[model samples]
Target: MTAMALTQRPASVLSRLLHRHEACRGWLLLAPALCLMLVAILFPLGSTLVMSTWSLDGYSVDRTPTLGNYSAMLGQPMFGALIGRSLVVATIATVVTVALCYPMAYFVAFHVHRHKALWLILLTLPFWTSYLLRVFAWKVVLGYEGVLNTALIGLGIVQEPLAALLYSQTAVTLVLAHSWAAFAILPIYVSLEKIDRSYIEAAADLGDGLTRRFWRITFPLSLPGVVAAFFMMFVPTVGDYITPAMVGGPDGMMVGNLIQAMFGPMNNWPAGAALSVVMMLTIGLAGLAFLAVGRLVGR
Candidate 1:
């Protein structure tokens, strides 16, 4: 009986300790994920930050810490321009994707009574194919003498194919918006679907019109999803090199392209790492600003 009591006493003390430290217990529950993130995310980020501080020597890494890479990045106007272009392209794509997808999500949430799953499946059908294939399709469509140009020419709208349609910032934006449409739509639909109809119905009962009810109750509640969509779209788009490489000609070349060049043909890993750090910091700051704006709007 004394032995059993002693064992139970430790168990009870442990239980009480855990109960007192709810946050500690929660962290224990999340330990696996935290460890994985520490290994995968933090380790790589720390390596990159360390690499950013190093410089390249002739045919070898100097392995000496220096701020020259960051200094050069700041002193150079070209880097700033590319980063700005990336931000603009990403921002425009995010806005266009969200704006276009919101109505579709709203329709699926509010109007689709039968086979909601089917509607969602249909909405996501375009994403079934590989991302590259979709981007290539856009390229074919936007190319000079492509389908759009051919159709317009046949309709007598123009004598020649519009060269501006492809290999431009606009082209990059269009491709990005098309690529991320599903990502923006799903979250928004989920948010709208989860909204209690009672609030909207009450607004209607109070003589509120559709727009008023949407602005007053529906939109505010869905701001979380909207904010999530914006973040998901904006972050990846800013660092997108593939779309820009394929279609973003010289004028549309972004920071991602430069970073790729630095690591690839240029073989300047340290500089690339520095640029990567700057890009990550820029995205973080932008995300914070966007989140703040979303919170303000929600209020």
Candidate 2:
């Protein structure tokens, strides 16, 4: 009996070892991706934080760590205004894109059967072009002597070019909205496509009107897409520098512009790094808040 029990212990120990070996293999399979993320993302982020504590000029570095940069940024009245402008532009662009894309997505999803793929292709066609070129085209169109102003003048709508039309907050919002439209449309279309057709039919059969059916059946399910679209538009717009630089007036400059200045001509690398970190944190927090709100509203 003692000999038999000793032999059984070896078998049990081997079984446990095999189980742990399988688990280790699974972890090994995931190791490459985890390593890549750490190298590509985490390393840069940690380095940036370290850099943010030290000031650097063009040719030399100041090893002294100070909160003076942050203090100066907070002291500036323009800092608050720039942050406000960025938020306003991002929010407006997100709202407009989501509202406009929903109907277009709905049409492509439910209304149009023939050439649906063609229509979707066309919708995404603009993105194939260079973003900077597209922005330049908008700049030309909104310029004082541009097509829009010329057309309006020809129609006698106005005697002169509206200087306010270009290089204004409105121009920034419009261009960003146009640029981000595809971001808004695709997700909503995907969501609407995934919804079962029978559900809509059943709601109709129950005598729910078109508006009522849409509100009850369609809208709730599409919340995920709406949330996705909002983030897609909001995140990039908040950090956008090019659009504001080209089209935005001095008054319309965003926080990204300031960060760029700190890194570039301003020669304040530490401040720029700090600002970048803060912006990332702000965006992360905002995204989490939006997700929470979306879940609550969905319920």
Candidate 3:
């Protein structure tokens, strides 16, 4: 009897609390996640903001609050060019990766009724091998006397290996696209898979062709995944330092490489912080604009 009374008392208390504030339970449930984001994301961002305002004094950091770091970053023409280059490379990679992966994703989502889990495992298998190893393999393949050159020479397609394959902007873009393909494909596949088959069947019953049905039902429903994939691919690729450094030679240098230099031999943490802040803000604005445009188009 006493045990039953205790449980009932708690239930009554919870009911009263819930009745008093409809949103309180929801907010309570979300508090842990919000706290986690505050610790992991907001704290680092706040620290970076604080660091960016510090002045650079000779070889050491000046704790004095000043906007010199931002002023210095804006003063450099090369900085602007690097940022532009990063955007261009990241965009190209995003587009190409999505283009290549979408058909495969579509195939798996629609045609492959059996071994669906196997296909997904295979898709992600390449990543299980270290990312650095894949880049290095590409480097070897693109080298002047590497496997590609050897195969081409053996086939008599060309008298000499192409010197232009490695350490260029083209190489950088290709490597980035390859590296990030899985990220793009999985999201899109999930989106396509989530779509109700009834919608497609209904469209077909209404005398719609395959193309019409896809355009009307499947494509629109899959866009949320596409948008999510785009952000996932674009944001990280822009900041990728290792791939660009390993295969991207002199011409392939992006803003990430520059940021790395600023922190490394240059010993300009404040300037790096400033550059990072601007880059983050630019990416956030671009993402917002993309979503805005998507919403308008959807309407």
Candidate 4:
């Protein structure tokens, strides 16, 4: 093309793009992301919903859409109990993880200022390894013939191995808390670190005691991070079956194990899909309700 024509074409393209409505421009920019989300998230979710309605008939999956799966899943008291148990364990993990994480984050943010980078590296070093490996490490440490039992036995603290340490609800909670500690700590640390020192100093200057300042200013500001940490720890722990399966014994198993069993040799795909969809919807609604309550309380 001629030089003048080429320049004119470029200017025309730029001018047209620049002159577009802001909302239209924004949508155009977001189109690629919307397409990706449609394929990756919505498509699979749609498939799952469709499959949830399919009933098994002898050999083939009956394509007829029916609420049979939902009826079957909801009718069982066992499923309700398992779901409640999962929530309880997840709640315990969230609370314990946050409780332990906040103090550590506070210490790191306030006390270890000099080697902060080194401390952060050491803090996250455990995550470089496989998540299961860490859970397994805990299993070894808590086993009947493992470190805790052997140490207690050597120290004459207990007469026999502490069988209670390895395969119970306690073990599940302990392992989950430990496993997700880093997720809790990092968000809290970031929030604590971001608290402008000036606020604390100003509070102190105004005769506010440390306790008063913390309750009035620090805790409120850090709550976003705390909530983030709680959800991060809570959501996955609800669906976690690996830690329970490896260390839980029969009593410690979560709802995820039952879902897996349904999908596996049980050949109950419709029921499994229904259970998963219902659980997801329940969790989502609960999260939304929580956010609504938090917003109302804040006002």
Question: Which residue pairs show backbone clashes in model 4?
Answer: none
For model 3, the superposed segments whose C-alpha errors exceed 4 Å read 1-35
Candidate with better lDDT, 3 vs 4: 3
In candidate 3, position 92 carries an lDDT of 92
lDDT to native, each model:
0.94, 0.88, 0.90, 0.87
Candidate 4 runs further than 4 Å off: 1-15, 18-33, 292-299
lDDT per residue as tens, model 1, 106-215: 99999999999999999998899998999999999999978999999999999989999999999999999999889999999999999999999999999999999999
lDDT tens readout by residue for model 3, 143-187: 888888889999999998888888899999999999888999999
Candidate 3, residue 181: Cα displacement in angstroms equals 1.0
* lDDT by residue for model 2 (182-230), tens: 9999999999999998999999999999999998999999898899999
lDDT (0-100) at residue 240 of candidate 2?
A: 96
Ranking by lDDT: 1, 3, 2, 4
Error of 4 at 182 (Å): 1.2
Clashing pairs in 2: none
Ten-residue region with minimum lDDT total, candidate 1 = 6-15
Worst 10 residues of 3 by lDDT: 6-15
- Taking all chains together, each candidate's TM-score versus the true structure is 0.90, 0.87, 0.90, 0.90
